[model samples]
Target: MADKEATVYIIDLGHSMGEKHSGRKESNLDFSMRYVWDKISTTVAASRKTWTIGVIGLRTDETNNTLDENGLEGYENISVLQEIGPMSMSALRELRSEIKVSKTKQGDAISAIVLASSMIEDFTKKLKYNRKIILVTDGKGAMDADSLDEVTEKLNDVGIELIVIGVDFDDPDYGFKEEDKPKLKKKNEEILSRLVSQCKKGVYGTMAQAVEELSVPRIKPVRPFKSYDGPLTLGDPETYPNAMSIAVERYFKTKLAHPPSASTVVVNNAPSRSQVDDGDEAIEDNGNGLGAVRQVRAYKVNDPDAPGGKRDVDFDSLERGYEYGRTVVPISDMDESITNLQTKKSFTILGFIPFSSYEPHLSMGEAGVIVAQKFNEKAELALSSLVNALYELQSYAVARYVNKDNQKPFLHLLIPDPKLESEADCLFDVPLPFAEDIRSYQFPPLDKVVTVEGTVLRTHRLLPTPDLSKAMSDLVDAMDLSKFGKDDDGNPTEYAPIDETYNPTIHRINQAIRHRAVHPEEPLQPPAEILLRFSKPPDELVDQVKKQIDILIKKADVKKVPPKVKGKRKRETVKPISGLDVDALLGQAKRTKIDPENAIPEFKQTLGAATEVKAIEEATKQMGDIVCTLIRESFADINYDRAAAHLGVMREELIALEEPDLYNNFLRDLKKKIYQKELDGDRMDMWRGKIIAGGLGLITDQELEVSSITEAEAKKFEK
Candidate 1:
């Protein structure tokens, strides 16, 4: 089925439906029913094609009146309405009358969905087109969170668009208090938005709005043919105007005459009289005729590899003379050794390169040079490799087409990696000019083209002496160049790999560094530490060491410091140390205590409260410096210039310190969080699948029944 068609299902009826508005005479349910019925009927009548419309109504429980002989229940108590066409307003009226309002339960909305889904299942199977289910209701949804999620998921799975229409949520008359109406409407909007986001093309709106939107049908655009202004001649006549015709004729004759076991003849023969005269006469007969013909001279088509080819062909102009019986020289007779031997023909060499391997930055000229080198050095080996690579790429293209059930001919190219530019250049010195032609070629639409990126090189051609010219020729000749029919969308279908963008080595190195920083490992610890330690010196080294020893002793001390309680009454005030005085004392102490023997005891004695505080401040500052160094070194390793930007030192310093059992707790918490996330994702996926399956009618209530969780189900799956 075409993707454009839409199957719209309009659902109506609910419990609070019957409740009358505070100011209005009509009930919410009555307004919704009439609004939806009128809108759907109008939309159906306006549609160009017969739109399959399924009408269902919702209430709390299933009714015998609604159930058919097949045990399938319709919308509300009436099950589903009978057939209704776009112009069938009476049928819609009849359906409205049949819908009986029942008690609204929490599961009513979900049950209604399940019932509608059942009806849709049958319809979708018969109609493989676009399916849309529009559920028209008031702001109130009776279904619980789990059931709603399940129903929405099912709808999505079946490729059904679920559109919800909430009527009169803002109407104070419909039992919605003026003060709470806005909040209720906002809540409904949020719920609808969340549901729509989960389902493709799903949306919610008022009945009036939805009808207006769905009424507009989409149209497909028409593509016009583009004209080519170049010469319409089949081949280079001056050289081998009739070369292609003769070759084609000979190829057919050989196949017919020889039947099965004939050697494939490489067409090297010059143009015959019959071939050229017939072609010229045919061209002249066309309305846009070639004027008075002059003496036809073969022009030299230069072969880059063969420098010695005679560059000209000669012929009599038709206007000048009706010359006949022109002598022909066979291609085999020409001195094959002469590099400049003129030929009467040209052919297009269509090659395929894997888009993954193609390096867009490498120019055609560069590729030509590489090809030439490879051919010159390793003739047979280079040719074989090129053939194999081309073949593999072609196979992939073919497989892709086949998977899509398309039987069209395609050419897929596996481009060479830019990293292999030097090697490729060395291998194929003279780049085939065709590579440039392809690079400049504009591609078709995305739907018509498929490109696979980031493919790793598996095997390459091994060569002894590469002959660039012969290799290029062999590669060109090996390809099967043939035209095929167009696709359904009227696009010329050919499977060609896209050119791969080149990534600079510097960028790659930077990426590696960034990745390492984010995911540091134990193996990197030593280097990381070295980098940190070398970046800065420990402040007040001697004092810090002495303080460390003293602090450890103090921590070990079971007795507390003397308290100044003074019978809880008389409090003694102590003078604070000034920054200037402390600095002076430290300066004097540093000058006086030069020797370790002198400094050690004095440092210990001076390591009062002041020394301890100083040690902590210095340690924290040093740690910050260390973290910054690690960050800088990381950037440097990747050749990135480190700007003098401040690292959030406080955060890093806090992380660096080994907390009391906090790291262990953090690890446990992290593991739990990861596990929970994974568990949640799996559950979501499962629910999503179930929703789709249910919507498609692939699963029923019996099939969807959840069994008790077993030990196997509880265990996490291994990666």
Candidate 2:
């Protein structure tokens, strides 16, 4: 089950928010919106039905919230931008239009908070949810301080997490302070900050902190899913009196995440005359009139008695088959049951092994957590004792686990994790790989070279010199991230923390998706600066290891490779790296004759040695004649292979020389002669087998556009 959340984002749109501060180009409202947009975009990307969001516009021109509609006082200039519901791209587009600088600044921030709390309470009613309220403002507007205590109590009573983010606010912990002397703004900031501090669960920070932290990817909070919740046993209770049974629950510790995939869409054709009167669209447009395409699959099998030598079968008629080597092995229901391992859901302690005996590489799957079953005090005490004993003895428990009935069992390595602060003790478990699953692939030794004569030599080019090896080691040490950053108290810390590093692929894709949804006509923006910030080493670190890098480069004798030319055939042919004009030199000879016995090699030499157009035409014409002669004079099917070999050589040479017309034009004329029985007496079998089967037909545009074969002509010639 997915978790339910109702979060309301209150953004101040007062007239003062339109002014720039601290020489920044963007307005204060836009600066504050950076945090708001990111939070909303994340929820939209999740696409979870239960993750609902609401938006409120503070200090707006008009009053339109639940309070203002009910004729409540002090709710003026505050409007509900959106209701609590699952967010979508359409909702984001609507919100973008609504969040702009307002003409008035009469609304009170505390009053807006009260109305937001009322909205969540009324919508959620008595249902349990992860309720939250986020407010981003510049603290430039007036805020009523009366009933502040009561509002805090109401937020805590309903379990709403209040996060207040002020623009240009002071926070000693964050080391930020706005250099100003406005008493009214200072008072508003203090009031909002106090409201957050008084709440039961919340965070109070500056907008700068929130915006700066947005680069780090947000980890989605998932509802704990119990894989199993039953008594874990050692030995059967009926078989041994000393058998053990403890109520334990297993939950996934980590799960894989994937970005949303796009469905294919097709254009909608015009409707018929009868359906033209209706205004209904064929399907939903993706910003264009293109609608999602429907997929139709037909299963068929070869049937000599059926039409077209094939018959279609319903999907239900298909049977599942398992692949055994190269063949599919199908089994009946009874046989499948016999083949499957019939085991009940169980987690049993198979045995214990020393922690040193376990290898981390042996863990194959995602880790799972096992804790004592809820409300079972005795089970908790027993599991805690087991965890303590395992920790003290430096041992791990190997358990046989079957997550469900009739499922295959797997071995799990259970490592104890004990907390000294009186937290519940639990075991971290990883499924172990079977011996058959491990692959022992062999690779040639990198430190030494073994000659084909079975002699080993260590001082070869494959082996790195001692100087190069030491230089590489020194470079690695110089670029170490450990102790690269200063902590809050000015202590050394890791530069790229694990919690801060994000998956660039996931976030970059999501950013592009959201951008396209909002602005279909515009090109996608570049990747966010934060996503690419950690891709390279720190510049200072690179500068420090300049000497080491230079030494390593010299030792390895590395040289820059030339850039590859794109679309060589689209323009003109690229020159060879040897800088020699082989074609021009070869064309100077103007060779014509090609030996029929040595047709392939001799034909290649004629093409490679030719430096003129007439020489190429002569050689190609002679080769075409040789191919037809081989097929025409063959004793039945004896010379078919020889003819096919000659055709293959002609095709390869034309493609290399970017002269597709030379091969395609000749092949087409040859195909016509064979099909029309002009080459030999009824040699269609050779045409079908060697010409069609070997794919030695015409050269399409895929080979090169220099060919004379039209799209229709290419298809007709293939048949």
Best by lDDT: 2
Q: Worst lDDT window (10 residues) for model 2?
A: 272-281
TM-score of each: 0.26, 0.72
TM-score between candidate 2 and the true structure: 0.72
Error of 1 at 620 (Å): 99
Query: How many clashes show up per model?
Result: 65, 5
* CA lDDT, candidate 1, residue 43: 46
63-106, model 1: which lDDT tens digit per residue? 43233455653333434554323323334445546665667533
Please report how far candidate 1 places residue 704 from its true position, in Å. 80
